[model samples]
Target: MLHETSRRRLLTGGLATLAGLPFGGVGRASTLFDPVPPLIPIRALPDRIFRTTVCLRPFRAAGPRIESERVGRKLVVHNYGHGGSGWSLSWGSAEVAVRLAMQAGDRDIAVIGAGALGLTAALTAQRAGARVTIYTKDQFPNVRSAWATGTWSPDSRVAMANAVDAGFADRWEAMTRRSFATFQSYLGAPGDPVEWTDRYTVSDLPPEQARGFYRAQEVTGFLHMGDRIADISPRSQLLPPGSHPFPTPTVMRNSGMSFNIAMLARQLTADFLMAGGRIEPVTFFSPTELTRLKQKTIINCTGYGARALWADESIVPVRGQIAWLIPQAGVTYGLNYKSVSVLARRDGIVVQDMGPNDGFGFNDTNETVDIGAAFASVALLAELYERPVPAVSPRTDP
Candidate 1:
């Protein structure tokens, strides 16, 4: 992983490794960021064609809801509408939801939906000695969580900075730190469901212009309010001129974590079942149906599905599409340029464009694949890496 240095004091823990620094000196990072390392160009060849998938992210203006409310003798703990940070904050949010459910003094818990949040919350409640049963409409390859970008972006479009509650920042920090530590345990596995890689934010503009790439909501939009908890993810360091591999005048480099969602789902499912948790393939169209469940305490983690299930008008859909290119065994890193992002996962290389200011895919629930947008994303990568003419290749993973 790319190690970097920038001194700033804050709460200390096992976060030194996240910054690519030594554990003993948690406050200081290595001088790695100061020196330019050997750069490798990502081989975005044209023949690297694979399948594509798109889904809408659940966004809420007031951040994710983790409070418990009564629903006809059933205590419901809401844990949906995480926006684009669903995968990033799944475990942390699950921890909060499960803790609330535990307060109900109920040994039995029913978790709705089987996506990232649902699975994590189910596993967490089961670990707490609760008889957990997950009710979901879909699972595995069919679940929307599998369509995620699988990056460690805890605050991506989570909520408007001014719209959140006063204690939201502190709660978010606690969740981020807990989630980061939990993800670390999944590393070093053979399937590599969770791992770290160097990611670069490259831009054609000058450093000053590229840094100020947004308007009023630019900083929060670009970083997803991550600045409030920047220490959780690897700190980004500006790359010196001409030192980076990409054809960009400026680059921001950092070490970040990603999940191979399919593998992660498999692992979590197995763990849950092993821990005596149950899963039922059931669907609910309305919140009133939650009362039918045998369990007295329920946790809602339906993601975008919550909009219709709970009539939550506040939950907005931010549509996002990804073009999965054939796996390039040689390319191990990821990069973002001109709003187009490219990441190499175990299944395939994912490429998506969030627009110039990281705001293009907001409030767009269109499920249809825009051929123009898909091709434009591919074209951006082609401009940076050289390759031969395109060739047809079958799907690498089912």
Candidate 2:
């Protein structure tokens, strides 16, 4: 794992370098009220970013299901299949699965998977007055949710075939709003976890392509919030339409909620345990092994593993790999170019391009994808997710 101190120093050095470098005489690293260069159209969408999009299929659990052994009859509730949005859709999805499990008429719930989805499921059950037990092969730290850029989820563009539906869009929007508010409740120093800030999303296209899901103004309310000024995200004039500094045509900019996923997960899990939630770290390869599960209700929060556990073949793998930067202090916002490349994140910068097509996997040396693809994704996401990017160069006095 990369050390925090070293990452900070690296980011500081990079910031200093940018501060001194000439960007029309201004700092090029400004996120708010700074000029955003037009996105230099880098060959089609996936061309310039994340050089490679490895299928996370390897990590995708397979079998009578991925990891299942039947020691006994353990009624299980499987919950998974949240590709990149695992952290973002965790709570909303968790609520859905938990609700189902609770209906099983059992006070004891067993949750599989330790990522954001799993952690949130455990906490929700405990809150609802249920005795929750979390069983997993790996702990929180080793889970992928801890590695996310920690952005607002529902990663709308991801692959969701058999299990999900078109109406999922509505559920996704609702979940985003609910989750954001829930996350806001735990923001503080001890949590060092969640915070709100302005995220300038720079784009080089018209509002349609730039705004993404919000491209339709009608859904903005349902998706964001009713409050045009605050509650929901709206496109404002952070910069003149044509004044965008980058090579793109237009820019979308907005401030958003962010978090240190790893820290947040740790804190949430700790709270869950304190609230009387149970944890069984022992891995059960067979469904029968779980038979000892005295709990009448079992909530399955296993991502990918759901394929075999329930014999749900609809669930497929969309691989994703994240490139973590050293860490730049005072940087809380995020940026993305299309959904392919990204740089703005709570912990640090990350470039990812793993979806249904590219094949799910990981490759560390794909830096070429980082510079271009991730950069483009940041530009696109900034304009759509947050506010519009400023046209004025950061170096400029104005």
Top of the candidates by TM-score? 1
Candidate 2 on 34-130: residue-level lDDT in tens?
5544333222233323232222321212211112232346555566665545665667666766776776467777777777778898998888778
How many clashing pairs does model 1 include?
Answer: 0
In model 1, where is the ten-residue run with the lowest total lDDT?
2-11
Candidate 1 is scored at a TM of 0.84
Assess the local accuracy of residue 80 in candidate 2 as a C-alpha lDDT between 0 and 100. Answer: 66
Candidate 2 off by > 4 Å? 1-74, 158-174, 189-191, 203-231, 236-238, 241-249, 337-340, 344-346, 353-398
Give lDDT for model 1.
0.74
